[model samples]
Target: MITADKFLIPARELGFNFFTGTPCSYLKPFINYVIDTDGFDFVDSVNEGDAIAIAAGATVGGKRAVVMFQNSGLGNAVNPITSLTYTFNIPVMIITTLRGEPGGPADEPQHELMGQITTAMLETMRLKWAFFPQTEEEVAPALKAADEYMKKHNQPFVFVMRKDDIAEYKLQKKPAASKKDFSITHTDHFELDYKARTTRTPVLEVLQKSVALSAAVIATTGKTGREFYEVGDQKNQLYMVGSMGCALAFGLGLAMVKPKLKVIVLDGDGALLMRTGSMATAGAYKPKNLVHILIDNEAHDSTGGQGTVTGGVSFGTIAAGFGYDKIYSTDRLEKFSEIVEEVKKNDVVTFVHMKTQKGSPEKLGRPKVTPAEVSVRFAEFVQSK
Candidate 1:
């Protein structure tokens, strides 16, 4: 078999230096190697989908990122893979371990069905994939093919790795000490007038004018993005369409890779609830450039205005528990504008939970710019010095 460095060194030479993924036994060596290596950055994501989103963010920030996870968790990654990467035409390399090889090994009962259909699943997702390189001689050609395809199509390429592809390598780096001391500041200015509170349009207007042109804004799916697009579209703004809960994670990834760029995530209550684990990830990494702004209308405005469970949920406290450096809660548009302006001046992982009325502007329309076009321009804006 080949050493982990055999493939990784070449991958690094080709600009694949940023890595993020969940653990798989088959991928342990690769992950360990990356963790121990001096030039690589590895983020252990909470789930497979978050891993893909994080890697996509890094890719958008002009870094060649690689995501690795077990095939069992590939199901978890399907949402972002299809909606985020495929729709946006953002290319990131994915290495998924084949845990349940049908005829090759007598495996656990859980892996049987997934092992049989792993390759088929990849094909169904319209993801071009190949069996991972098995020999030293195969590594170069395999990476070349994947790299060429990704560069040409601007879509993700997968490598389904079987067990024993790489020689075992133990991780040498020490785990980071747990963060025991941290503070969260909550500024509550809610008047508790749900109907009288400001709607999304005015909030979007304030954000449009408040956010600096140098900062990158990522709006979560649904009315938030639509309203923001309606307010005004800019080169620095990315209107997320289908990846409902990934805005924060994507912003975190971009913030990590592009430390100089301020990454703002305009999140919705429903979408934020869908992947609250991302907050914990953000808390752990604590990217100083991330600004998470949650407009909690307490209803899913895009989906027929269904009421969500966030009415009683205190997201500022949640952000505090999740380790955000700064937290602000408010219902007034003026206070929110102040918070935005305040956070823009400082480099801190900040969260603003704004309570707004649950409604949309009349006949709100979607963005005319396609997701692919937005991604291209957003990436260019991110890469600009």
Candidate 2:
């Protein structure tokens, strides 16, 4: 039997000592070893996207980060994987535990599809990855190769683990905080230069407006994602890019997969405009659980603020037409807050529209948690349902 602890020492040697992820039964042995170790830094992320972002940020800061998650969390990590880190040249190590290898045994229905596509999806992203080493001796070299790819190419790498590879180990205390604390300065702020005569600003202000109201927030692709993450509690929120208005779609998936969680999808005019079909989908599903907030800035702000259909179209009318149980609109913060509060009482999908400015953050940083941490926390979060 391989001793998981020994493989970890090589991880330390390779300068990939920091770890984060959600635990999969397929990865439990390795997860236990990590949690039980004293020298590694492991964070419990809310989901795979959050973990991927965290690791991306850490990679930019000159630390190698590894994210472990189940094959299922791939759907959550896809946007950021392609848009944020890949577009920006940030490198991270990802490890996914394979579940439901056919004929090995009968597994849960949920894991079957994930098992089939986990590796293929990684390839679709063109990520350099490896499976868990069959022998403990191979772990060091495999990790070394992964680290080299990250440093040389500025692209993400992955290490897929199998059930047989990871064995149980004692939980370890989290490593002490590293000596250096890095903070990102925002050079780009999508702001409204002209102060509004009324309390309301443009629809983009919905994110800041929501945070001000202490409402849980999420941001979609492009500037909306960056601005929301920039303004909200970085640790609690989820953001995506290149999904191009599929924010609600992802949010719906999260809501359905995790029923008890109160999910708020911070969608933009362009994104919602692209995936308007989701509105009907959501209406049909009747996820009484989600509040779909559309920030109708009326322009593709990230893509140079091009005018959108919402400029002449009424989003509020659209929401009502689409069968939203409750619909609200506001150009002012006070009105925004009041409408959100009123909508809180409804047990159906609610839509909120706000006007925002056409500006993007100057610099963007990805999340720091590894893929692993996100899966672990997300699953735990879901289970708490």
Candidate 3:
């Protein structure tokens, strides 16, 4: 067996310094090693799928990220792995432990079937994976192969670790950013009819003008991104074509790695409500550079104007409860722009909720650029500074 450092040190040297995962017993040593190391970030995620989305965000922000989990939970990660990461051409490293090796050991019944089909499942997903390195000499070559494949394909690579592959390493101290003692603080409520308020189009317009040229704007799927693309397209803007509710987490991941850049997430009510858990994840990380903008038209405007429950929902209060340091909500366009300028200068994670009317331009067009092309240009822009 090899020490966890045997592979991780090299990975870190190669700039894979961000890590997130849902833990497994076999991952104890490796996960502990990553947490104990300085300059490496390890966020214990709520689930495997969200972990992948977070890594995708970090990858988009020009930082290589690694995610670790149990092989059995790979099923939980399929959606984002296929839709979000694959669709956007984001590359990340996945280290999953094999719990029930076929015919090698008698283990828990739950892990047996998963182990039998793990390798095959990965192949089906078109993920090229290698057995996790077992010795000091094997680590370098394994990592090199992963690095080359990820760089070439701009997609995820995997290392399937087996039982006892890593020698035990005890965590020396409580990690500096270890889970904290926390509580949610709700925002003050305000009743307003967005019918008399601004619509989605001008909100995009104001955002296009307020942020710096170097700032990155990640708009959620559906009409929100379409409207932004219609307003203006730039290298700094990434119009998320799929993975509907992942925009905020994606923006959070980017903000975490590239803290100097202003990263704004334009999320819609339907999308935000779909993945409400992501708000907690974003709030937990609390990246000062991230500005989460939720525009509530109280409907899924892209899908025949179906109404959402956001009319009675106060997202600013919910975001505050999730731990955003600053919260702003507006029914007026001028007030929204003022909050944008104010939050741009505030060194804290902030949330802006805008009440808008349900409507778009008569001819709002989809982004002309393909998904891969958008990803490449966005990556280049993120790395330029």
Candidate 4:
């Protein structure tokens, strides 16, 4: 079996230090090595798809990232891999463990089908992949090949890892910091219809104005992103095009890496509800520069304005419960603007849940800049200082 250092030393030498993934038994040793190593940053993702999106964001932030998971969880990863990474031409190193090898191991019945189809599924997804490194001689070449392919295509390259490929690597310390004594509060009370509250336009306008040039803004998918673009696209703004519900995770990744740059996420109620677990993930990491803003329009404004059941939800209470250092929930535009301005200067991990109306401008336009261009521009701005 190859020792963990066999692959990790070379991978790190090639500037692949940012790591995020869901845990799997087959990947335990490698994950332990990554966590214990001094130069690596690993995020325990809530799911495989979120892991991919986080890695994509790290890539855009000028870091080479690796996302590792069990092959079975590849099903969870397919959406962002196709829609987010593929569509945007973002490159991330992918490492998926072989849970059910077709002929080698008679393991659980659940893993059998996944084992057989894992490589085939990757092929169908049009992602170029190679087997995980199993020898000292193979390490540099494997990473080299992945680096070349990713640099050329600007897409993900997979390393299908098999069981017993990596030898045991013991962790010397806890993977996380000492748990902070924090609590979450749940409060939900809204009494307003779409016609009574402020529309998304002004809410976005205030947000666009609140962001300083040193800060980075990430807008969630759907009308929220389109509306933010319509309001005003800036070098500091990144509009997520296809990775639905990934804005918060992306912001978290950016804030964690670029600690000096304030990273704010402009999230929609529908989109936030889609991946609420990401909030818990962000709270767990507790990046001081991260700010999460959720505008509750109570509808899928991008796709025909279907109503969502957010009026009954207490997002601030949820954020506080999720260990956010500060929470703000408001229905008034004045209160919303105040909170936005406050977070721009504050260093605490904060969440602002603002209740807003459903409608946007009559002629909402998509960002003229393409997703790839947005990623590059945002990356450049983040690293500028």
Candidate 5:
């Protein structure tokens, strides 16, 4: 029920100046205000945990901090909070904008469960947090209470607010950046007219070459997974079932745990377009053994074959902006081999872009396993590391 300016002023007064996290419409007014202001340092972190880590580092260096994020990102923040902050006695204030509140008209089905579990998750971590303050007047006191709680406990505390309570602000859209192609050379062995073929053969050839050297691969949903599955052994690959555009997170966890083995992720244009922030997360935590191979088909081929933003959208540039040091693109096979060889020895996170065919094979069905089973397999894989 509080105005964005009101809470922001008190947050400033409390010495909480540094802000980090993903954008939320409900939190935009507060976020944009800090961004436009001269004094406040606002960083749009790749995920919630990155925000937490940034805030934690700032706190350690003698600055008060705030991390504002969507409740859906709580899953991503839990590890850092419990392992790094809680164990290390780091205190940071978290302000999360709640999405699907109970009794609010049903929101996107994808967010329903995440919404319901938000508070329970905080409790499970034994961290202190409170839902929407009862009135606009309560915002300042709630923040103060959380600050006091953090000081006393040396643990993170969260303030969750509903959509209706916060104000929205307009965001300035930047001009589109120049496009960069990730295709190197075509490894296609066939002699057909290369320009007319509908298959993603060139990209598949590159992925096959990568998998031949790597121990594990994770593919995001849509055409990338389909094509990667088409070219490589599914037994060594984790077919992402439901979580669209989350292959990097999977690869990050796997790579972090198993630094000795190579972890590859086959990402898609549509899938990456949906959640591009994962690239920043990929960059923040440098893992030498991790390789993200993006299969850019340039369309949402799995869902009615709609055109994607990436046709005009350049993921290669985006990866570069997110701090991927080794970025290469080519439409030819020699270039592909050059980039692949360069990426193989790098001791840092890498992103490879490969343009592919527009559509996947027809009659694709969901995996026979349930979400729980998929999670179990992923858990087992991570544990094996």
Candidate 6:
């Protein structure tokens, strides 16, 4: 068996220093080593999908990232893997443990089917993968091949790890104490007149003009991105297409890696509700350069205006509960613009919940720029000073 450092040291030398993933028994030694090491950064994501999105964000910010998770949770990561990484051509290394290896070891009944199909599932996703290096000599060649593939294709490469591939390494770091003094403050002024409330177009116009040129903007899927693109496409903007709920997590990753660059997420109510757990991760890390702006129209506007559960939900309370450093709620466009300006002046994780009318500009169209093109330019924009 190989020591965790044998693989990790070289991986770090090759620029894979940022790590994020959910915990797994097979990954204990590898993760422990990263946590204990001073040069590495490890983010404990709430789910495997969030892990992927975060890693992708880091990759976009010019950091080589590695995501680790168990095979059982691989299913949870498929959506972002296919939509976010594949569609955007963002490469990040993925190390997934083999929980239920056939004829290797008897595992829980739950891992049986997943174990049997783990490699098959990777193949189905069109992800290039290899069995993880088990011996000291195998480590270099394995990493070289994976690195070469990722650099060539600009897509994710997987390493399916068997149990006990790395020697045991204990964690020496202690978890940080929780902050008890922080409190949520809201500035709710929801206008009862729905007709008088501003629509998405005007809000996007304000945002396009308000945010600085160097700041990176991540627009969530569906109408939010479409409307933002329609308002004006900027080099600093990344329009997410298929990854519906990953904008905040992506922004979190970018914000963490590129702390000097402002990362703003344009989120929709339906999308935010789909991956609310990401907020918990944001709260925990509390990246000071990140800004979350939610335009809650209370309906799935892109999907034929189906009413969502957000009408009864108070997102300001939810953001507060999730540990956002700043929370503001407003329905008026002027107030929303003021909140955006205010958040830009602060060095804290902020959330703005804006209640807007439920319609887009008539005949709204998708961005002419392809997802791949957008990602390439966005990564360049992110890495630029």
Candidate 3 pairs with clashing backbones: none
TM-score, per-candidate, Cα-based: 0.97, 0.52, 0.92, 0.95, 0.51, 0.97
lDDT of 3 by residue, 95-140 (tens): 9889888977678999989999999989999998999988899988
Residue-level lDDT for 69 in candidate 5: 90
Badly placed stretches (over 4 Å) of model 4 are 175-194
Better of 3 and 6 by TM-score: 6
Candidates in order have lDDT scores of 0.92, 0.65, 0.87, 0.87, 0.68, 0.92
Candidate 4 is scored at a TM of 0.95
Across residues 77-191, which tens digit of lDDT does each residue of candidate 6 receive?
A: 9999999999999999999999999987788999999999999999999999999998889989999999999999999999999988989999998978867786655556686
Model 1: lDDT of residue 82: 97
Q: Weakest 10 consecutive residues, lDDT, candidate 4?
A: 182-191
- Give the winner by TM-score: 2 or 5: 2
**lDDT per residue (tens digit) for residues 1-385 in model 5:** 5566677777888888877788877788778788766668776677776577557545543467788998888888876677556754668888887787767766888789888888888889998988757476787778878888998887888888777676565545453474585543222222224344345545666656765635567777655555565565444566654356556655665565467767777777777776677787777666787888876656677787677776556566777767676666554555666777777778777888766556555664445554334444544544454
Error of 5 at 213 (Å): 6.9
Residue 373, candidate 3: Cα error in Å is 1.5
Q: Candidate 6: where are CA atoms >4 Å away?
A: 179-187
Q: Count the backbone clashes (under 3 Å) in each candidate.
A: 0, 37, 0, 3, 12, 0
What residue runs in model 2 are displaced by over 4 Å at the alpha carbon?
170-385
Say which prediction, candidate 1 or candidate 3, comes out ahead on TM-score.
1
Worst lDDT run of 10 residues, candidate 6, spans 183-192
TM-score of 5: 0.51
Candidate 1, residues 8-124: lDDT per residue as tens digits?
999999999999999988999999999999889999999999999999999999999999999999999999999999999999999999988988767888999999999999999
Q: How many backbone clashes does candidate 1 have?
A: 0
Q: lDDT (0-100) at residue 216 of candidate 6?
A: 96
